[model samples]
Target: MGKSLYSQIGSLQNDLNATVGSTENTQPSSKVNRVTRDAEVTKQQILDAAVIEFAKNGLFGARTDAIAKSAGVAPRMIYYYFQSKEGLYQAVLEQPASEFQQMLEQMNLEELPAIEALQVFLRTVIAYEISHRYQGMLLFQEANQNQGKYFQQTNWSQPLTYVTKILEKGMQEGTFCKQDPYMTTLTIAGICVFYANAYENLKHLTPDVELLSDEMIERYTQAAINLVLNGVLA
Candidate 1:
């Protein structure tokens, strides 16, 4: 028989604990060349582990030892490479911004009409969030933690700059209502991130909702597009 969801969560927690404890207790190996190679390996592993760690636990609750274990690295190696867990979280975030930007750049948005552009962008955003759940989870965690200052410093600029241009185009062409482009971007992003970030918590609240299913995803995408296109006015 399959385990209960609660038991599965408990199992995951317990496994993380064992992995963390093992890494924390092991002593670093002594070979210089081996240490260098190991350090590089550890750093990559840490980056991968950190996306899940920071996403699940946020910055304050996530443990360095847990991250190290998840990455299969010595506990201290995270500090040696990243200086702190916060630094590792920042590194994990860097890739998503560039990846999103490259994807956006490749699309010839200028060729599409305004409403078509909006729909296309929504589809792209939803696809990206769905496909890159880990990256989306990290973003969701950061946004949920509401570390406004940190996010403001790190990410607030680039995406806003790009999105603002698109929204401005939409507004000018009368596809969208005249609204603050920046705030609209936040609303659109919030719509995507909230469900993902809160999925674990939400599952408890709505146990019958099979959120990961293809039907639900299509339902969500359609609802999200409608909500954005037509404001909540009965």
Candidate 2:
């Protein structure tokens, strides 16, 4: 066994850290840092494997043994870290949800006029989902098959709330045709989300096209934005 996985990951982290500001900004490598990085590396390994398993088999159907094998860790490690299968699934759900929220926070979508905000939101969400297509499949399973039992437990409404606010703003300004913001928000989300969630089906449109390639993503993003803007236009 040459360099272990942790060794490889640690080396990569070192390289990444080196690219940071001037050498004066660097901290001396410490034992604690290495230990912490390795632990996080292990956890990320488990999450990455769990995404694949959960996407293929919904929460009730996914197996710990399979996840452990795919993660190259002992089955016990999953229990030790996550406490239970549900807990692990929650972590998977949480990571991406939190990331999207953070991305939203950074975007300041509320500052823009409703129409511009809507376009930005549509493009942002479509791109986000396309980049994480596997997670989109996992989300589809949870939403449809699991009845969103796990998702509802999360702060999943933040994005929808953002959309609703934008919609209400547009309606108020007479830029968008008046409609129920909450209902319209759901409709708009379905429009953007379906492209990624139904990717497996969409891929069969023609064998020649790479549905997730950069060109297709832009096309899909623009199409979704256009559809929503057209429907809402005053």
Candidate 3:
């Protein structure tokens, strides 16, 4: 029999820590760096596979075996990394928010005018939804089937707060109509994700459309931004 999954993961973690500890003490060797990189790659591979599985099947329908097979790892590896399927599902749900936070952090949103800021936010979110098409589908599935139990556990406050501040700034600056920031945020997010959520049906309905193509995505993004900004602009 091969090595147990628990032992395999523990060993990899130990090796990773040892490599990092050595690097802290002295200049890192090429071999140590390579090992560290490989470990990180392996972990990411597992996450990539889990994302696809969970997105396609949702939590209740997803299987650890399928994820492991897709990742080219042993079945127990999933448990070793995530503890359980539910844990992996939670990670999938949290990924978009984490990525969204990182993307927003890189932008100089505070300095932009409120109207421009809102437009930027809308474009960014719509682009993200298009690029990560599975994420929107997964979110829709969770909302309808699981009633957003896993989604609630994720920390979305950062992006939500960011959008709320933009709306408030717009209202204060007299660039946008006064509205409930939270509700407005919901509406904006709905607009950004609606196409992605309905992609399958839309594709079936319009076989020639290629809705996810770059040109179409650009058209959709621009149209959404225009529609939203027009509705709220003072």
Candidate 4:
């Protein structure tokens, strides 16, 4: 028979405790690395659970106890790593922004044609918004209720600047008509967010449709990319 859930959890706890109790000075380097890795894994678990809680309830409404319960960690662990609920919320926002920056760096947009770069950027945003639906909703809530205070606290400028550079490149190449880069970036971002923000309403209006199915996502993504590109293309 498969292990019971409680038994599995108990086994994991035992393993974690053993790793933590291992003496750093006496243990081999491999054991020390295991301890560090285990700690990171535990911290990540708490963050993942906190994301769901914050997305559903917003920062003001979410509770640390609930996050701990959801993460399957002791409540003290949250305080130990994140310091406070607000700290964890900040980390959540920062993590995605950091990932976005890394992705832009890896894309090497300078090598691609202006139009191709724009398409790749749009597709990436749309796919990320679709996969991380709750993140979009949480951002929306933060903007409305918190006056975007948390957003201002993170390093979001790099990604915004990256998009603006793409737009500027297109204009310089004479492939896209001259326009305000900031406004153009906003327009493209809005276009990508539209379907995701309106998903529930769309589902209500068309009760038979699976709006999130792969086919529908592809259709919407392609349509949005084509529309944005056509508007900007000279």
Candidate 5:
């Protein structure tokens, strides 16, 4: 109801639009191109369509036929590629997390001190959430609909544990103040995720302003950084 919240929502809407591929003007590929590459392309198409449908309509309300139609593929292709609608949803969320894991593997965690590590980690988390808006939408939906129980059972659980481990290591090395690692991780996640979901509210709260522009995203990212690092760093 506040302008600040409304501004955040406007930003989120823009991010969501970018994430769902709605902003792209993709033409249908030739049916003659039904090679292995074509199959993978079609599979991505179906998943992209599914993200739009599922984000707007929830799981039970999302129709496979509509997803197939939007994707320019047969309805059966959705099932053939993903096994089920829910399977496709899980894939959408898991794919980005897998990428995050790869990025983490390439990083030298021990080299960065606690404050810098937290800053970099939080930046990555926020950037990923902004870029992969559909994944955030799906994760939010799962959290509300299943109360986070479903996520707890999936590969989604790995990131939280990873963050906790980093926090513990920082504490052991006297780089961060003593505190509950899990709680700190939850706090960081909440600040990024709650703003995303409540973007509509943020938009209303901050009247007469554009919140999704490049400059505004930079501001939001910095504000998030200030909040988390200030309290955790020794």
Candidate 6:
């Protein structure tokens, strides 16, 4: 059974108590011997665990003790690498930005026809969004908690920039409606991510809805794809 929201926070705080009773002594490891692979592995593990905690609890509610337990590391090690829990949250925010940048690198968006490129981009975004749905909530938490200071700092514009380019190409090719590409990109993104970021509220609204089930995901993905294509395609 899942823990209640407040319970999750309480449990994590308890774990934090166990992991690092005193943070004053805990600091980033000063000892380094050429950035060993083992250390890198540890950082990755911590990152993975931190993502879960940050996503579930947000920055203020997330507890490093729980993250330490999940990552199978001493609390100090988190401090060693991330310097602090907030630092770890910032890194978590960066993970998706890094991923999107890497995904862009792997795609030959420029070679594809504008419509085809847009399709491919939507598919990729949906897949990425579904897999990391929690990050959207994490981002929402960022906005509500800090007025989006960290979000503004992150490189989240890579995909959007590509979408803008795709719109320009489609317009130039006379295949898509000539409209403001930037606003269109935002509209497309919102339409695609609506269900994902609204899970908490939505699940309650329709308690029977299997939001993450394979059937629902496929339905939502197709619906989003079709809607965007219809809107943009001339």
**Best of the candidates, lDDT:** 2
Candidate 2 residue-wise lDDT, 1-234, digit = tens: 111322333443345333223323336655556666667778888988999899889898999999999999999999989999999998998777776776777678889999999987787777667656788878877987789889888887887899999999998999999888899998998898888888889789877999776677677777787888999999
Candidate structures ordered by lDDT, highest first: 2, 4, 6, 3, 5, 1
> Model 1: per-residue lDDT, tens digit, 1-234?
112322333443334323222223345533454566555566767877888888788877888899888888888888888887777777777756655665566666667766766666666666556655776666657788865534654653665566667778877777777887778888887886666556667779878888866666667777887888785111
* Candidate 3 wrong stretches, greater than 4 Å: 1-29
Report the lDDT tens digits of candidate 4 across residue range 30-141.
6877878789879888988988888888889989999999999999999999999999999987766776676667668779999989887777767666666677777876
Model 6 residue 230 lDDT? 89
Q: Give per-residue CA lDDT, model 6, range 1-234, as digits (tens).
A: 111322333443334323222333334432232245467678888988998888788888999999999999999999999899878989999877876766666677889999888877776676667666788878888888889988888898887899999999999999998899999999998876777788778889878878777667667777887898889888
TM-score of each: 0.67, 0.82, 0.83, 0.85, 0.77, 0.79
Model 6 alpha-carbon drift over 4 Å, by segment:
1-35, 204-209
Per TM-score, the best of the predicted structures is 4
lDDT of 3 by residue, 105-178 (tens): 76668889999888777777766666567887688678877998888999877888888899999999999998
TM-score of 2: 0.82
RMSD for each of the candidates: 10.4, 7.7, 9.7, 8.7, 7.8, 10.5
Lowest summed lDDT window (length 10), candidate 6 = 1-10
lDDT of 4 at 25: 67
- Which residue pairs collide in model 3, if any? none
Cα-based lDDT at residue 211, candidate 6: 79
Ranking by TM-score: 4, 3, 2, 6, 5, 1
lDDT of 2: 0.80
- Give Cα-based local distance difference scores for all models: 0.66, 0.80, 0.77, 0.79, 0.69, 0.77
Clash-forming residue pairs, model 6? 16-65, 28-80
Query: What 10-residue stretch in candidate 5 is worst by lDDT?
Result: 15-24
